[model samples]
Target: MAGTPIANSSTKCLPEGMPSIMGAIYPIEIMQDAKRLVVLAEFLSQTRRVHIGEKMPPADDTEPSYNGYSVARWDGDTLVIETSRVRPDVLFFNVPHSINMKITERLRRSSPTLLENKVMIEDPDYLSRPYSFTFQYKKTDYKIGEFVCENNQTKVDAEGKASLQLQPDTK
Candidate 1:
């Protein structure tokens, strides 16, 4: 299990992307307006924009990127988001997915302090069929802080284990 590149990108301060971004270890900020919804992640300060009330373009027209092209609409009490053209490598973990991969997320509030997200992932070449899972996030009182990966020094040994090289505060 050593020498694996599971955190390869994160090791270099790259965006974790997609599902990885949804991990609860860090908090994300969501902002909305009449035209688009914006999500800001604590890691790398990554951002994803989901346009509201717009037609999703074919893959041919959507250029692949870390977060992919996304469009959103309201379905009664739920907010539905369709994402496509994500750089296959950034789809799930840092692992690669087929270019045909697609992700759809339906989010609704289960309670005043709880938000539920149902995610469906599809990739004809990588999966036998589509699969889905639901994730629930509870409202927290934590505040977002400035995160700068470069400030943390780290060293990876030959066995692929990474260690933090704690830096003394120069303040």
Candidate 2:
């Protein structure tokens, strides 16, 4: 049987890495301080941190993770963030990438209430060249809500395909 598609990892309650996490339908909240900033997703309650103006450790010095290691600095009005050392298991958005993937994101306020993130993805092993996309978020008074993916009732067969578990009839 083929391995489970990375796109379905969320069905198994796994963290959906990087750009996919930031590009989700759910709203995200950002909290910042002098040293770092954090992004909090309303979906699955996932959190990501970026150390501002800090040096990123070599891949060998840090563990691979869904969000990887991120370092950032301010470029004029934009905050430039670069992430590397993501796990070989990358984005769950159907697009496949390799272990050498490096992601750069530029975030800025496009309007008084709108924030934009321009993302650039690079992976020579999986992509012919680098590619980019953008995600915009509107400032809202809405509170961030909690979501627990762990409660999903989907069942996976031995082959790694996922399906909804059918409840037995009580009639």
Q: What TM-score would each prediction reach against the true structure?
A: 0.82, 0.87
The best candidate in terms of TM-score: 2
lDDT of 1 at 135: 80
Q: After TM-score superposition, what is the CA distance of residue 152 in candidate 2 from its true location, in Å? A: 5.1
Could you tally the backbone clashes for each prediction? Answer: 0, 0
RMSD of candidate 2 to true structure, Å: 3.6
The residue-level lDDT of candidate 1 at 10 comes to 72
Top model number, lDDT = 2
Model 2 C-alpha lDDT per residue in residues 52-87, reported as the tens digit of each score: 989888879988888899999999999999998888
Least accurate stretch of 10 residues (summed lDDT) in model 2?
1-10
